[model samples]
Target: MEIILWIGFYFLTFYAFLPALVSRIFGFRVFTKGRSDSGIALTFDDGPDPEYTPKMLDLLKRHGAKATFFVVGENAEKYPEIVARIHEEGHILGIHNYVHHMNWFMRPSTVKRQIDQTSDLIKRITGTRPLYYRPPWGILNVFDYANLGYLQIVLWTSLFGDWRKKIGPDKLYRRMKQKLKPGQVFLLHDCGSTFGADRDAPANTLSALTKILDDGKEKGYRFIGIDEMIAVTEQAKKKNKSRQAAKGSEARGQEERVAERKSSIGPIKKIVVSLWMLWEKLFHVLFKLRPVGDAHFFNYRVRRYSGPPLDLRNDRTLRSGDHIMEIHFENQMLFEMGMKSKTSLQLAIRIIREIEKTLPDLARELAVVPKGDQVKALYGVSMIHRGSEGLGFETFELPKGLFARLTNVYLRFLIRVIHPTGNQRVREHSDTLNPRMLIMERNTLLEWADESRPNRRPNRERPVESSL
Candidate 1:
């Protein structure tokens, strides 16, 4: 019996406690907080209370603030009018399970059913299914990661013990006030009827939240929904990445200028590169490109294509307005590599290795996006036309039009900017440096991910030159 009890303890630890610890400590497979400059996300749980929820809504409306409410399924079903009101008011709704129970105590299937039921209920009431979920108490089981891929699991950056009535409004306000900075996800309770919670605790929460909302407004903070907060965080990350890229380019340019003091065109080249980097920044901002996983070598943005139809290999044709993930090489990274390499061939080999390392990460990142599966192909135009077929890409000549001509000029300029010998290399290889479209269908990309193949050198028979 002693041995059996030990086995059960170990099993429970592995099955639940370990996973919960990983998620809480490292935020694995969970969105704990956001990165934004001017947005604050206020999220409430155990909500839709008959008395307190309406008051909270009224206070929020008066302050012109938006929030996210993770409502218990049972409570939401009972007071659906409150749920409807929440939707109508443009506040985000998230699932908080059917009851106030710990996820560690539930089976994987049971957790999935709870989420599905709650999501269906929300859809029926608000005509929109909720995409975000917060497990009760932010606990997780081992299977939660595998089972909940379709839903984004949210945690919080700040949690005050507002569910206890004795804390009162004054103390709660002070605690919440300390976390009033941008990009904070505040976890507060709006319904306090659960076990170990004071039933009237939410009354104090409401009172404290009213003051916090007014203070946040007066401080010029935008109280936004969690969805908007996530979007803003992504935009912030892109902006930071652009700035970092510009700094890197500047550093590289300075190093080159110092090394080649005899070259009178160095300062002029640096100015041109700075202007080019500014254009890249503007392009990223306009297109909203996202980095693939944590890899800075590649960024992509999904956009509707309005170009001419192109036939693909699998009896499929991509027509105008089809969604495609347009891929862009991180220009600074390429420029740095070129500055470090001795020749265009050496730079091309280094770029190939970097792509091999980053493609799998890009595949995994795309797999999680909501519209990722719907995208037709990964597409880009580059002067790196040679040896692309060896990397599972189909190459095509750009159509003769204004867009094609502009792309040709832009890519040729990029190659010169990133080449080790700059204009000398371009003059030597100008005939072969024209831009061409490189495309890999979604299915082929997924196959690469599924195989998880080891990186290999490109075919040596082909010219190993690329301006990626």
Candidate 2:
């Protein structure tokens, strides 16, 4: 009976108690995901050790790749310069806790102290605090994660269990290579896995890195930091959130404006002016631009994703000084007063004519599609105006056309002078875009103005007689 009870106790520890302990201690969280279709994350934990970090940094430099090292507080203090070197080389250093203790064995105070001390040391060395944390031996606890909300909880998708010496480098390398995939965060150790003793595993880790690098190159994988991965993911989330908020806000706002238009003049103008001013402030904050004239533009600076076309040179030898302006207006009254009652169709024709005159060759290459069937449908463009003077443009969809690639170039003047809300539709569409402008040396609008005058004969004759 005694033997049987002992056996049952062991089984309970393994099956029930251990897993529950593990789950509670290491609250389930993924550090990095879906940041890159072609990028892999190389993460090191329980490190900043002298025996290996310098060499690893050297190897990474040779390969021209960056890795994130999760340094133990004690180790970072021992080799502050080595940690500094990691930062100087453009790599990332994240916290692996100070003492590298097991959470289940540690008190809450100890865990907090360990995290804080190590973070302070890293900051003192690198000038920027780490925003990512990896638990020693993958033993993360719920309280740990909750307390460390500022840091991301990183868990490995593939690891060689490389701290064990028994595993040969070949096996370790093969295991890692086979499991590697785009968007995977791989776990490797710099000094050794926190789990002590297993001779083959630790050395094999460094050995495996060379092969991992080569194999990843073969597979077209790029490597990025955990912070970068999480940032991109967060941005996508924020954009979606912002978009939803914008749609709801705009829809409700429009309805309110319509209702008020039928009822009151007393408060509506103030409301419009307030809304316009708010958007202007938002744009200024987001893009750091103060509008000039009646022209206001918002620029999106997206990192990590492929950006829009950057070439600003006049295509097809169009003179540098030539300029063209295309204005989009929802109100016919404003549109007419701004440009002498010119219809959108007529304006487009006149602008196209100016382009042809500036660069006759491009004119020959240009295929002007008929009015009703624009070469491609334009992206959905909306103008929101709450009152007579409050107006702004929101762009969402892109119409497919030959001009799609060049649309960003020609779009500067068309953006309305209005305040901007973080419109989700616009953010989602413009996520990977960059700020750009096209220069036409001679302002096409000016040329067209001169051409639009009928003959200029009677006024010219009167001026000449006065001069004589």
Candidate 3:
């Protein structure tokens, strides 16, 4: 019996007695305060009183001061207009439970209900979720702290024990001044814990509040709400973290991957890249085959890059997100035939003539792709059954014969209108198209070939067999 009694006593002591003891002895943080001692947050609890709250608001307004008010849900519901007024006047509201009790020692379900009810009530009244919450007396045991994040836990740096009448206005003010610091959150009372009290508590608080604000202003202290206080602290912490990261990066002897401002874009290199861009753009315009959203087109336009060679035999691989494009023998021909030339654009022009001779009747289709239709879904792959030994991509062919159309347009424009060249095939070793190399995007040459290899098409919605 004695052993059981001792266990019960110990548990009770830790639950009930420890809250006050911890608050008094250790002053341990239930949550961290603002990073600096340069600001003040004046918070009041147990408010929305018909008698005291209005007076407090008026006094605060007169001094051009704002505060965070933590009020009970029952009191808030009874006087919702007061709650709305508090929010309208630019003061933040926080949860202080539905009823004032030693809730920290209560069961988890009881505490959860208390918090949820209070949060809902405050949110409904003010049309905003209360950002902060404080269990009565800044106390929480094992179960009390569970899911406290439903409304964040906040505790004051200084509580003047203004709830007691004997402390009086004068004594409370003295305690407040003594405990005051730059980042201190001063806790005071606006109304009685239960409903119906003498106006003494609020009156004393008003007197104390004026003195503190006056003193704070003289010391160049900014009075902020709990939200601002938390935000400022978080900002300070992030800045400090960034500084530490910079130092660590410096220690590692590696700077962040910021673009280096080159002194000059070399004369020859700039000219070459510019000409290549012009040639590529014209190729797309003339052919009427713009790449699927950026992809090679975007890379050429803005983020310029050139692969070693092309692999036409690859499957349609995911280039960027969902858009897929054709991988052809153009890059291989460029590297093998045009690589010896100083300018790539000149060699590209030569290759266009050779492609025109290979397929003489090339022209732009002049038809717009149907809206909301995928290219692969709309056009089936046209399998040209020429033997693999002679042709580059034996089974790889774009639907609607796009390549043939592009070649015809190139030949007509270049041969008849502008300049002419010998239509000889630019031959290169098969090793030029490296199977493992990602010709464009993240796909290897072989992967691109596989997708273009053609397979059974996805099942289409056939007019809903019987839409009864």
TM-score of 2: 0.46
Candidate 2 local Cα displacement, residue 174, angstroms: 1.0
lDDT of 1 by residue, 97-135 (tens): 988899888889999889889999999999999989999
Per residue, candidate 3 scores C-alpha lDDT tens digits across 1-468 of: 999999989987877666544543344445535666577788888887888899888877876777889898889989999999999999889988888766645776888788889888888877888878887766676565556666667787666667766657876676677545666787878986464434566778878888887887788777778888888887889999888777865544332221111113346644654565457545544454422221111211111122222233334432222323332333223323432332323543444334323221111100112221222111111111222212222232222355555643443332211111212221232222111221222222122224354631122221111000
Off by over 4 Å in 3: 13-29, 193-199, 242-468
Of candidate 2, the 10-residue stretch with the lowest lDDT total is 385-394
Q: Report the Cα lDDT for residue 397, model 3.
A: 27
lDDT, each prediction? 0.81, 0.54, 0.55
Model 3's TM-score against the true structure:
0.48
Candidate 1 stretches greater than 4 Å from native = 249-468
Give me the candidate number with maximum TM-score. Answer: 1
**lDDT assessment of candidate 2:** 0.54
lDDT of 1: 0.81
Deviation from native of the Cα of residue 232 in model 3, angstroms = 0.8
